[model samples]
Target: MAEPQAEVDPKTTEEMEVPSSDPPENDNDQDAETPKKEKDAKSFDLGDLVWAKMSSFPAWPGRIVKPWKNVKKPAGKKAVRFVFFFGTEDHAWVKEESLKHYEENKATLSKAGKGAKFTKAIDAIEEAIVKNQASKSDMESNEQSVGTPAEGQTTSPYHPPSDDDDDDDDIFLKSISKPTKDYSREPMAGKKKLNSSQSASSPGSSPRKGSNSSSPFTKINTPLASPKKRGRPFKTLEDGEVAKKPTPKKRPSTGASTAAPGKKARSDMSFLSLNLYNSFQAHLAQKGETAKKDIKPTEKKIGFIGLGLMGTGMAMNLIKAGHDVTVWNRTSEKCEEFVKAGASQAETVSDLVSSCDITFSMVSDSEAVRAIVFGENGVLDGISDGKAFVDMSTVDIGTVTGVAEAVQARDGRFLEAPVCGSVQPAMEGSLIIIAAGDKELFDECESCFQSMGKKAFYLTDTGNAARMKLVINMIIGSVMCSFAEGMALADKSGLSQSVLLDILNLGSIANPLISGKGKAILANKYPPAFPLKYQQKDLKLALAMSEQVDQPLPVSSAVNEQYKRAKNMGLGDKDTSAIYKSLTH
Candidate 1:
């Protein structure tokens, strides 16, 4: 060490100081430093975006307004607080622990281009507030000097006079006394006096002060400038009087009123008058004497066949829409109710098809639909070019395709429109109609569809609508079976059936069908809104169609077996929810 050591510089040795054996401590310095460190640890800067919580509200995005402290608190218990602003006018004072920096990944500081603009504007406003406060204080201090009155003036309107009894009495007398001269009686020098009768008749009439004669209240003998007339000028006689009657020059009829000569008809009239005029024209039309241009052509005649549960409501809606509807049913009695509701009764299906521009059929099954279309005196026999046939029945794809081909072969248009709702939706005009084949025919029948359904979807191929219906029905059947199985399992587990339904309603699988059917199943009441047998038929058709395309539907096949079991148990006429009863019993 001695060999390695080099000579130390005197200036470097003087810079180094030796430590004291016992360091002198100042409590004031240590205490002040501790507080500063704590305050710096808890402080947040202005304009910093943070997440803050209010007393009862959830944590929301906010920005720190300022560092605040409760001065009234005891010294040691006192802690720094933050003033936070949520939006333009909402602010809260919260603890330091209640606020944190906003995570950038979770949320941005603010919307784009808005944060910077808001901060700059807020800073300007705060500066203006400080300046205004200072100006207010200065003005208040100068108020006493500015408010002092000048010599020979009173601060208030009223001033107490010198102590003089005579002066006070004179002021009082003058304030109470009326004027000596009456202005109403005094007339201006140039104005003429109005007659007593004229003055008495015109309550507000008075002479003009300085004019020669012109006054709205003055009665002058001078003739007035005539008013500018609108529209055509009236013909006058040689004596400058209006003519009693106009010359008979022919005027073209314009379906408007004509005023007599020298008289103007009012332009404003109530809507009742217009409605009555329209009614009179309609009456003339019915008599075949109205103007050709004013007459409305008759509505197209619409025909409805197979007035079953669904078809009856559909036909009624068409009649309600003001179509000239003709309805036919196999039972013949079913048409009576519709006939009473403004629909004409047809003795045969052929008569209905022949008379109507468009004919709609909604039968039970493929067999019934085939009989109604291809049988003698059926739709095929009556259809001609320009005629349209729409089948609203749910049937197999092959059946609908066959009917569509037969219809087109006879020079008639065909549309396969199977609806996806039950009797209630049909009655309410809220059915979902799936239509395919003949785009022009679909467009032509759109108005009729609107009257009977909520929405109509047009598929391009003939069999697509039938396929869609089958697929939807298959899903509906599967869902109902699953609902039933869940209900059975819940019951076996001794859980409340109603609570299970409520829980399901709160979850993802909740739907209108499930809610309605679950309630019905719980009550052990299955009325036939949709019969079980129909659901079974749709499932069978769906399975058969799936096999044709080599696609397997295991879930649908299982649901179909459950529906079959329910049907075999004599619940076929009950609602589709009856499958729940099969599992329970």
Candidate 2:
């Protein structure tokens, strides 16, 4: 039996309260300390490529980039780079310790890193890096041509000395070079220092990107300050040549990215969602409507795939909650009921994803998940900038990560949302949603989740939801098997089985699983609510997960065999309480 979950019924979604925070920089930077920096003393130069490690993922081939959506200084002040991973459409301010030369993990730079599909990203990043370098060279040449400007004529903004010249800012992380500058707290030359407005519109000044670009802003959770605060304030000359000045005398630009304020751009997952949200709010403001804090956001087009026992109930709840739902299933017949119930039907998964803003998929296993998502005209084909994909199926970490990468690589948001409940809870909109990935998407889908679940928690990362779901179901499967066996023993001892159930239900052992399944067992009818086969499947997956960490699970191991035994006895399709029949037979 499971422990009682929290009944979180706050008036508004938690996202409304927090508005979401910075990405997991501190968490990922734990291993990026001084010791690791000391271990690898080699310095990286601009356009220098390396293999950057992120989370537990395979080290991806990344280029040392001076321009990214958010170029924050890396940890330990290591000679690190904000690496833009070529094939994966991901970027990280990786520590020098967490990176190695590209030749380490990869053999050679083919057009394809993993496969031909990734060739586009590889070519794209390479072109961007080259273009950036070429642009810098051009700027430098122009600066040399211009020489010094007359006192009043602004030749260009100041350019800082090269990375080798400055130990105080060794990383040369000017997008955030040598991050210790502490832009907001630190002052620039007492009172004569320019503010954010001056940097944005000042004569010959270069603009900085988002303050959110700095993990420091995220750490402090403050609104963006002027980019001049982060990097040196540079002014564009009439001839477009930038000059250099001594540090502490006047700040100098790193000449990393040409982009300045109002042109702040990011090409990651947050790029689309954040821009969309800001645009929506801007529209409301332009119309003189109440601010977003008070205004209810427009609902997203909802999509659901799989119309099995659990999927059906969940989809029906979404419709009943007045969502504009479009549905798809492997079996076409199952979609008819939903179509008749004010829901629209999609001809294929691609069509479903194409038409919807957020698509929810719940399949039996990882293989089925792959077949739909990776199949022709599947999710990969349909994913675009404005759409999000939430897979609520019970799956392993590998499958979840694969789907997440594929979707994000294409600029589509993905969340692993394996639910914890069966048919009854699904129909009642009382399932517990364990979701991870795309915090922005989670915030946007508040109403849809509220309609489909009793409570939904936004856990961290992409694979954690699957892990949590597996562990929960593992316990449920083991307990149900134990319950089934105990009932069989009561009957064999010639004791009253009904009385035994009453005692257990009345005592500490009582939970929805035992109490509900116990009644069905007593009635001798095991209609498939939570199928025995699926229960066994969850246990099997849990066992596999345990093996990865080298943890022993003797109890779950034994329980899994019992489930297999029951399945062999043709009780696979029946409700889990039918495991009693396995004991009896």
Candidate 3:
């Protein structure tokens, strides 16, 4: 069937009319309202100071002789070039288009600026003229005072102030009346450029024998200096040598005093202190930016050592979280599991540490942890001052403390984060991590641990995590042993294991471990939720720690002895629930 077409309304058609080809014809009126281009271009004045780009075309130490402008030119070209002259006979012609507006204002421009050499000369001439005028006025006053004498006599008999007069005028009169001597001594060492005119006037002047002009100090004996000398008056050595009078010491330049306090008073210590402060502030700002980026999508390079059963799953979670993960294991074959899940493999501990920014180790026991941490090719060899190392193994408190000290000595950060729960929790990414280290390092690496665990608790010291892990596993061992004894007693009383488990589940005796692993134990299933050997190690460490702290743990010690018997019987390779077999036997 054909579709029906709707008719367009007249008002809607007019609203959608096509635009005209030509623009609106009020362009002249708009231009008249707008300001002229010349007026805009004349913003800069003759003496206005501006900053130009420090570039090769204008050269270094260059200045603009003219300001920016817009000049009409031939149709083909749209710009007029301005002249800029640099020192050392260097100059360039730059287009007005190439120049930008100067940042400084007219008041800032110096009269003795780059091309204004005449400014200094003009100032000197004006100063000399003022000095001459003052001297002429003083001389005219003196002549008038001397010519008009006392009017007591018909013919005035008067005299100028005599040098021998004991009056108030003696100071000025005596200094001028004293006749200067013409004493001239030999020019001493390092006086190579004695003025010829001065030496010629003093015919009695003679050289001091064997004194060379090349030495730094010169010794000369003279009374009056020749007015024709060009250079400054430098002192000459020799007692009674009335050499050329010394020039007054120059005050610091006015330009130096005009500078800001920060610029004026500078020392090596101040400069270094300021530099250090600036560097620290810059680093903090960079870290803040990095933290913001981390909250978004970030690629972290993670190292996973000891790719055992738990390590494999934890490494997999990190990979799923889109981290760059590298794995290492003593057995070497264990890394293949994570390698299949897109992880890079490290042949040795050093390889892992050297490649990653943060390293995670989950080895077997205290000894295994030590081997990986302090061996020749250990993580210490790869760890650097800025790198962080995390040990997730259940070990003795002493071992953790020792490893932490070693890492600290090397200027590396250390975090002991032993986990609770076994292989199942590890696989599900639900392990509980207890961490201890520097607070900043703990906070920085918490997210990486979160990838493998449900939550992490930061403690105070490196030994805290190790002690906590031992305490938790001691409870697990005691509880598992109790359940084993109860089950054995029930079996001997002719009650079915299923009925006993069901009854236990209904009562307060039931717990997650008892319900979950007890069912498996009742069915004779021991797939190693927690390995028996590791459980035994944790029990041993806890017993020793308890003894040291003067705390009693009779049940944990008994459970540890049973684990010792099980280990001796070669059941150490079995799951922790195999403790029941040891108890029943």
Candidate 4:
């Protein structure tokens, strides 16, 4: 299929040699690479903001430029548009259906995008587009000055449809002797030009100060790019660079690589080797892409709900690890801290859920979790296919299962990942994550889990992780209560509470909870880490679960009463270690 000519402004410096959009053909040529969608089909013209995707490649940002006509195509194939890729300075012919509207794919593209490559691609493409528009305005002014074209030539034959298109990475290369633009940071001007007589290793190897020289691997006889093979590759030259001519060699009897009598054969001499295209692929991949951003695709577009002490620390860890974190809180002011720390603020749970790939919520009790996930403008309101919702709140198994079922019913995924360890561990990125439900979603969250926690266990069932979380918190409450009792008893006996803490923390039974909370008790500073009420709530939930399972917990039963006494004493809002105050009061 031959491509048609494109109209130009003749004012912009950057010339985009692209093809115009072809008319939709009545053929069954749509491959698995792109599915046919009559509803999405719309007309498009030159210079539109469209996304283009090719077979087996990630989507790339590009715009339609002027078309070079008469490019023949295979029979029974769909029409294609010439797409000039953003930063790579590459071009390709893309199918009409393969294009998506930029707005339609913006969030998905942003999630797919990262690194210097994606950023620079979009930035440079946008700059070019702005300049192109400015140049168009200039051309219109000139047209008025010079009198218009013949009356019939006023409207372009290829007028763009609606503001819509698609995206992909179907990049193809056309060989040229020189690059129109240099991709490197340094300007490709004013460098020493090498002569044919210069030897590769004749002079001394040490470089002079302040000299910028490329590595030998990057400096080859041909250009630092992959060009299509006709017979041999086309010669390309960088600024101040030379393409050396290879001396002809006689054919070998075994048909091995060709080499001049006294010269080493460059691996390139064997273009017909078994892995020729594979080698080109590897080289092109390195040449085209810059390094990745700290946040890879797996960890992009993370939504965090709740900004309480534990949520604050965990969400901060995600941000610090370079994930794109969007946070929402009941109190808008609480989100400001996260916003200042390079996180986006979502106004509602639905907004966060709809915009983000995976939303993780860590809030107060079951009521709070239920309220945020089920109320007006809540998580369910934004539930869509492929969205993931993970509740890290300390809710009971019944609550977890209910949320999970509701999410899955609405075509969204759900996971229960209740964490162990309090504010200190959360802030330090060492919380233990107990995860279950939707194994695939759990796997997708691996990078995020690693960022906010030291260890993560996949318990493989919806309520299993919540049960584990309850068990862990119940033990935490019981142990802390026991520790408080011991410290209070030691103080009364004059055995030195500090000494008791040191000995207990160093013994086989020593733990961070005992050591840290013991210090808090000694200082008589009852700031909340794991608040007494939440601990008591966890105990209360555990007892309820025990009742469901028909189990007896005499020690936990007694411990729950102690926490209740503390709660009634107005110590519920204080740290779990505040249980010591019940005995003293």
Candidate 5:
């Protein structure tokens, strides 16, 4: 199941608190700690322990993972900040009173019982003072040995710490690790019993009085607080995993249709019901604009053909945006799906051509598109001098140019709008629409396309859309193939398939495709989100296009071979990630 997600808010990490020993009336202290003067502080202060008030509740301790004073900035400003490793987000601001000089502070405090309490308390106090002094000495040494900044002046705010600092190699080597909570996943059912009793008794809820005891700000117990029951638990990416981009949401029905021509759609499918009412109301409002040439509605009628995965989604948006739509598909079955959902279906290409103000085509490929639009019974037979036709198919640049010429010969306007995305993007109305051809036709169709997609880019020529589609798909193929190779190598190195996935998930190198499809690949689930055969076809086309342009595409060539092999093995209809299985075999 896809994880539940919340809109991410940017969080600013809080700086660690610095203890001050100045008198309460020392108004000059603020000026003394000028951002510049603070930069000049060469030694760490060993002043009396002063606690900063907590900003938030349920106090949790932040480990002073690395602390520095008089840290020379690249621009020569001295900073006296420390980096703290907090286990949870809640207690990031709450500073602790001095008691945390050592791990034994708690044990020493526990011994303060009856007659032994006096001596024990004295010992604890002395230890804390001694540790504080030692820390001060170390700080002084660090300041004296500070190195010069990389540049005399800095342009950016963030810079690396100087090498004079301790050689804690782990600090540099460690990846930014979040806990392994899948934030996208929905919470599991069933309420968990809260540790209400323990929490009520815990000092985390209350401040300790008097003695320098950091009892309220205690270490967090990682195991108990997780895994969170709702939403994806934040999991740290492994060293090399790439960050995954969120998948776009499916487009809202908005009272549109999902009914296919002949299939009985679910009763809950309201697209048809709502859109039907809308279509009737819209039809009435337009009055004589139905077929009359003189009276045009606010939005002109746009003809759309090939109501498959891509076309149907785009057409629905066009209708939903209040455009008068006349749709046609070679397969009469496909047209019925839209027709039943309130879109009027054109029974023949001539009818769509003669009637449509502007038409968009999203057929399977170049051949089908050519046949539908230029054949004996094609759109051209009925197309007039000023008609506009937009083709949104991934086809050869040559084919696009050919279609452009043919449509223009008939005196009709033409636009090639091969989109750069898949089913999910199309469904989500987030597909990137790339257009080429007559500028006027593009402008005319712009609003209708916007209703179907998030972005649209117009190219100077008609074939650029085809070229861009090839470029984008080439990258997709290479990335998927590269991931497959990496997974295969990891599996062969003795890691379980699941463990390999986990490592990838934790690393910065993991891509969204891997995490989203990793489990399915492991379980051998090959439901075609994007068909394997179609991917192979695109790879072949991309490589062939590369060769035609005198471009060297060795990486794409190799990936294409992999997909071809997978196709040959009869995995063509499965998901593209099935390439991993082919590699293993």
Candidate 6:
């Protein structure tokens, strides 16, 4: 509007530039800037060798296969990325900041020489990458051929290549190369080259010394030396002498086939002398006896009286121990069983005592014991010097003393051998024998004692064995009474009887007797191991003995009443554990 705007031409107004807010670009400035852009862009390139740190793996050498970018990020904001191949079919995406140019790290890389195995592994990885790229291109071009089957065929799932097919390729990448020895030989000034066969066979054919100029590609002849042992070499002596080996000692010779004197002979005996000795002895008996063996005394003849419950099993054990046994019982039928089992039967108790060297009597009571010893044709009628009598009956102490005195008057040895076990121990040969009387008689009858019992205790006086047997029986009766009461109390108290028995078995008072008898009581079936009547009789004798010695045994008296109560209930024929029924019923 000022001065009508000079009516400026449209093209001139457009060409007229306002004062520029930014500086203009020029050719010299672009020439100066070109190198800077090029330097930034050329920091890394495809196919460039680099040392890169990928994840937590060690800094390994890799080749940049391609440039990459994060498509999710804003343009030009993300870090420059590269796809690197790390020599095994393993490729990784790495950032440019984590990599260094291979040329700049040559000093560090040269320290680890590219060994033969490493070179082979790198070559293989490159071949694999090329093959993989080619296969991808081929698959794209033949896409229509894939997943389409011919007529009458079904489409199957595509199977990837098997790992086992490339196992050898994997093995090569994992292998480590051995170090090569440096054996460069200098080139001679006028020498001719040798062929491979001549160099292999010749010895001492090295190049001349002072030939400083050597060809880097020249292969020197090196003998393959034997490998050295791993540890430090055996040390040499300071005087340069070798060590001497130790001399071995010679062994002395033993005399051939001859045993020394006073030792058993080592004569080569026949099988008849070794394996068939017992059969040979029997054969000799079939013929006349050999004079080489002297006739020994026939084994001592043993006599047993009163084949009762305990007596029958005790006599059987004696016969089984190879004694010449003669047996007698009042019933006479009991003797028939023993007579059939290789035992001789005596017509009467007096015949048994007179015919045998030792007589053992296990009669019922003091009166029965007296009738066998002092009655008509009794043991006393057969007593004489060198003959022995062992009374194993549980009798009153007075009866035992009387029998001992009568036997001593007849000049015969007497032993009051009262046993502490009943039928089971008698059958098993494990009774506890308590013997008191002539010590020489006890020593003479030790084998007989062992055959009938497990152990024997020798008391010096005649009546002491009987007294000890009573004391033990007293304790047994008291314990049985207590056990019966305890079982009865347990039943009434709602506790398990078997569990209570188990607790008692594990307690300090546990023994074979309690465990065995406790089980019998729990089953309420009293198969007689020891007759209840016999236990009551033993208890009665124990109380009488205690009374004779002026010893008060309130416990023995109480247990005796319990046994009598059991006997009154007609349980005397049952086992001693039947006393439990007396308490509970």
Candidate lDDT scores, in order, read: 0.53, 0.54, 0.49, 0.55, 0.48, 0.52
Candidate RMSDs in Å, in order, are 40.9, 28.7, 43.9, 29.2, 25.0, 48.0
Residue-wise lDDT of candidate 1 within 1-585, one digit each (tens)?
000001111111111111112232221221233367675675454444555543322344555442111101112333423333322222333445666665541244323223332353234334433533554565577773434222111110111111122232222112111211100000111112211111111111222232343221211111111111111112211222222332111121110222235432211111111112222223333445322222222367788876544565567567656677887755333343354445666656777787788888877778767777877677887888988899888889889989988989999999999887764455445578899999988887877887776689998989999999889888888888898899999999999988999998899976667766777677555545577888898899999999999998999998899899989876775678789988975
Clashing pairs in 3: none
User: Given candidate 3, what's the lDDT at residue 397?
Assistant: 88
Q: Model 4: which ten-residue window has the lowest total lDDT? A: 181-190
User: What are the TM-scores, per candidate, against the unseen true structure?
Assistant: 0.49, 0.50, 0.49, 0.50, 0.49, 0.49
Count of backbone collisions in candidate 2: 10
Model 1 root-mean-square deviation: 40.9
Assess candidate 3 and give its TM-score to the true structure: 0.49
Clashes of each: 0, 10, 0, 21, 30, 0
Give the per-residue lDDT digits (tens) of candidate 5, residues 1-585: 100011100121222221122122221232244566543653322222212123232221222222222121111123222212121112221222322432344355334322222242344335444544555565577774323211111101111121232221111111212111111100111112110111111122222222232112222111110111111212321223222322111221221233235432221111111222222223223343221122223376778876554554567656656677877654232343344344665656767777778888776666666666666657787688898888887777878899889888988888998876554344334567788889988877767767666678998777888888778777877888887787788788986877878888789966456665566466554444456666677778888888887999898888888999988765664567778878987
lDDT of 2 by residue, 1-585 (tens): 100011111111011111222342331232354366553654664455666554323345567654321223432343445554553323345556667775444455342234332353455445544544555566586775433222111100111112222221211111110111100000111112111112111111122243221110001111211111212211321222332321011111211243245432211111211222232222333445331122232378888887654575567667756788888755332354455445766756787888889999877777768777887767888899978999888877899999999998999999888887665455445577889999989988888777766679989888899888888888888888888888888999998888998899789977666666777677555645567787888789899999999999999999999999999866665667778888885
Kindly indicate the candidate among 4 and 5 with the higher lDDT: 4
Collision count of model 1: 0
Model 4: residues with Cα > 4 Å off, grouped in runs: 1-299
Per lDDT, what order, best first?
A: 4, 2, 1, 6, 3, 5
**What root-mean-square deviation over C-alphas does model 6 reach?**
48.0
* Model 1 TM-score, 2 decimals: 0.49
Q: In lDDT terms, how accurate is model 4?
A: 0.55
Error of 6 at 419 (Å): 0.9
- lDDT tens digits by residue: candidate 3, 14-71: 1111112223222122122224674356443222123322222121122333211111
